[model samples]
Target: MQITPVTPDLAAKSLPVIADAFANAAHSDGHEADLVTALRHSSDYRPEYDAVAVNDEEAVLGHAMLSKAAVVADDGQRWPVYVLAPVAVTPAEQKKGLGTALVMYLETMAYGDGIRALSVLGDPAYYGRFGFVPARPFGITAPYEVADENFMVRELQEGGLTGVHGVLHYDPAFGLTPQA
Candidate 1:
């Protein structure tokens, strides 16, 4: 399978398949639709931030997204970062390392583009293979309640998350309503 940046037309065409994969993967999770919607609207949803793995026949087998993220600095500046979310592989494609290939490709692309850090709420067991670890080590916290082990970050640059702290602010597309 080849991992490639998703073109606009291909992205649109693959939405239904990606959504179905996400829903099935996230079964019983209250945020599947919200997550899908957020992914569609996020600034990072561009062709550059999204990718798909296609088979020799060019059929999309997996999808991944990396979006804008921020870490608050001691002086109150928001240090730019990236958030990886809702990575999905077709059920039939699971356990074949397609997800790993997709993520590794995206992470390398992100680093080449100057993205220093990446955060995700995902299984550490899977992501740890890619150097992701609990974000708390770098003083990072999720905007919503999440299992500490599930909220993880990886620094692409040396000491990328060093001394970084505060709540991670995702792009507004995450569907979090502000208090009145």
Candidate 2:
């Protein structure tokens, strides 16, 4: 399988692939596909950070996105961060490392762009393999109540979160109100 940024053609094909992937997921909220649509229209959207995994035939089989975000400290300080959400892989395409390939690709892209940190609300068991750890210990908290284990963070570079800490503020496109 090949991994590449979501071009217009890939985007067109990946939307349904993404929607259907989530629709078949037992853990989805059924709104992840819609969230992707809204996020694309938001100011924080980064087209280059939206990526897909394709087959030899160039059929998109999975999708992943990283959007701009921040963490606000009690002193009103805001630190830039990236939020990884709604990674989707067609059921038939899962378990073959397609999702991991997409995520790892995003990680390389984010680091190349000098992004210091990434946060995600996902299964710790799955993300842990990528070095994700509970964000709470790093002084980061999710906007909504979430299991500490599921709300995770990873530093792209050394000391990326050495002193970073605060309530996470996801892009408004996520339909989540930022908490001060």
Candidate 3:
């Protein structure tokens, strides 16, 4: 399987697959696909961080993305960052590591882009495998009240989070509100 950026053609074919995958997810709120769509149109969306997993035939197997976000300190300070949202793998392709591959590819891109750290709100066990840890310990917190385990962050660079502590604010697309 090859992981590649979500080009227009790939996105046209992959969105439905991504929607179905999340629709069937055990923890989905039935709106993850919508979130991806909204993020795609977001000004903060970085196409380079959006990706798809495809087979030898270029059939879409999975989809994932990182979006612009920030860590805001109480003193009115903000540290820009990225947040990994809605990593989806078709149910039929689940357990074959397509999701992991998608995530790894995104992370590799983020690191290359010089991103200091990134956060994700998801299954701790699954994300932990990628070296994610509770954000609280790093002085980072989610804008919403999520479980300590579900809201996690990973430092991509050495001492990336050092002295960078604040509430994580995701792009408005993540809020799931209709864009004005």
Candidate 4:
């Protein structure tokens, strides 16, 4: 599988396919489509964060994105961060490591571009292999009540998230319940 940055035109077409993959992956989890839609329309959606993996024939088989994210420090400062969301591999392509390849490729791209920290809502089992740990380790929390393990962060630069503290504010597209 070959991974490449998504071009503007390709981003438009691949989004629906990515959404469908999210829907399928989240079928039993509920709120899959909502998450997918939020990521699609989030203000942070940029071509730089969008990527697709294609086979030798150029058929898209996997997709993923990274977006602007922030955490409010205890001192009332906002620290810039990045969020990875809606990573999906075609159902037929699942278990062949395509998803992992896409993620590694995107993270490498982000690192090369100087993005230092990233967070995501995903299974710890898989993400841990990529060096993602609970955001709490960096004084970060998700807006919603999530299993601490499911909300993870990774630092591309050593100590990237160190000393950063605040509730993680994902781009508005995440559709999280408002805090009462």
Best by lDDT: 2
The TM-score obtained by model 2 is 0.95
What's the residue-level lDDT of 29 in candidate 1? 63
lDDT of 4 at 148: 91
Off by more than 4 A, model 4:
26-43, 177-180
Candidate 3 achieves a global lDDT of 0.86
Q: List RMSD in Å for every model shown.
A: 2.8, 1.4, 2.2, 2.8
Tens digit of lDDT per residue, candidate 2, span 1-180?
788888889988888888888886777888887888888888768899999988899998999999899999989899999999889998887898888989999999999999989999989999999999999999899989899999999999999998998999988888887822
Minimal lDDT window, size 10, model 4: 24-33
Tens digit of per-residue lDDT, candidate 4, span 1-180: 678887656666575666567665543354544555566676666776778887787777788888787887657788888888778877878898988988898899899988879898889999999999998867788888889999999999998877888888777766553211
Return the TM-score for candidate 4, rounded to 2 decimals. 0.86
| TM-score of decoy 1 | 0.87
Summing lDDT over every window of 10 consecutive residues in candidate 3, give the lowest-scoring window: 171-180
Clashing pairs in 2: none
User: Per-residue alpha-carbon lDDT of model 3 for 129-155, expressed as tens digits?
Assistant: 999999998888876768899999999
Give one digit per residue, the lDDT tens place, for model 1 in 137-159: 67888878888999999999998
User: In candidate 4, which residue pairs get closer than 3 Å at backbone N, Cα or C atoms, i.e. clash?
Assistant: 38-173
Whole-model Cα lDDT of every candidate shown, in order: 0.77, 0.89, 0.86, 0.77
Whole-structure CA lDDT of model 2: 0.89
